[model samples]
Target: MIRRTFPILGVLTAVLLSYGLYEALIGAPTEQSMGDVQRIFYYHAPSAWTAFLLFGINFVASVVYLIQRSIKADIIALVTAEVGVVFCTVVLVTGPIWARPVWGIWWTWDIRLTSTLVLWLIYVSYLILRRFSSSGQTPLMAAVIAIFGALDVPLVYFSIRFFRTQHPQPVIGGEGSIDPKMLQVALINWAGFLCFACLVCWSRYRLELLQREVEETEALEALLDSRKAQ
Candidate 1:
């Protein structure tokens, strides 16, 4: 059923993303203060939200895997962590670009910015551990790391509320307000990004499952050959 739906989902995702691009770049009104540069916020904020969601899912999956030792759960944890890192990378990159012109610098060590960078680094480490580790307990270790990493998400989210920072307070739910039309466009872009992220995760999950099956088969064949020699 899922296989059958992939094409349909893929097409829908493409349309949403393309329309989102059009709306963000042209259809949406330019900001009075930042003008064209503020346009990056459409992509930037949505990417951060998507990354936060993916990391949250990763945290839950990792916990499940730790408790049940289920291969499926482990695969899900791995997939979400991988995709989450990519989305977080988008946030990190776009943030600096957006900051450069506004802040007159490419980066800052403010609480929000620093914590976000740390969150990205932690997940990047999780992926590195999964990729390079030869230990049988790699999944367990990775799950532990994932849980630790997820703790930072809240800090990244609330830093602006708690700390005086170079980063502006969140427009959605803070002291500041946003134009309704810009908010609408931001939301449309977010919906598009959410759909795209789900599609990517689903595709990655399938590929991971296939790769594991091949590895297991190869291991089993080797074992059978060694037994026959005995």
Candidate 2:
């Protein structure tokens, strides 16, 4: 069932992403203030939402791994963390670009910006721990880090609400509101980005599982050879 669906999903995702690009660029009306520069918001906001979602899944998977010591759960945690970092990186990069023209600065040490940078650092550290640690307990350690890192995600999200920040207010829920057409385009772009993230996560999970299988097979062969030598 999943195998059949993968191709269809790929095609659909491609269509959605292309249409979303068109909508973001040409279809969406120019902003009264920022003008075309505001178009970057379509990409920037969706990337953040996608990163938050991936990290949330990573946190859940990490918790499950800690409770059950399940290899599947550990793999999930690793893959999600890996992908989440990528989207998080996009957020960090795009934010500075948007900020430079608007705030007349490339970066700021505001609560929202700082918390987000910390969030990115935490996940990068999580990935590093998983990659470099040779201990068999690496998964457990990584899981613990993931749980800790997830704590920062909420802080990053609510920083603007709780503190004064240079970042713009939320369009959906805060004091500011978006144009109806802009909102529609943003939603469309977000849907495309979500689909893209799902596709990437699924592929990464499968590849990780395969690599594990190969590693186990090699270990088994080496053990058998040693026994025969004895």
Write down the TM-score of every candidate: 0.89, 0.91
Cα lDDT, model 2, residue 181? 95
Give the TM-score comparing model 1 with the true structure, all chains together. Answer: 0.89
Per-residue error for 23 in candidate 2, Å, reads 0.1
Candidate 1 to native Cα RMSD, angstroms: 3.3
Segments of candidate 2 deviating more than 4 angstroms: 152-175
Cα lDDT of model 1 by residue, 57-157, tens digit: 88999999999999899988998888888989999999889887776788756666777788888999999998888857889999999988777667666
- Judged by whole-model lDDT over C-alpha atoms, candidate 1 comes out at 0.85
lDDT for predicted candidate 2 compared with the true structure: 0.86
Best by lDDT: 2
Model 2 TM-score, 2 decimals:
0.91
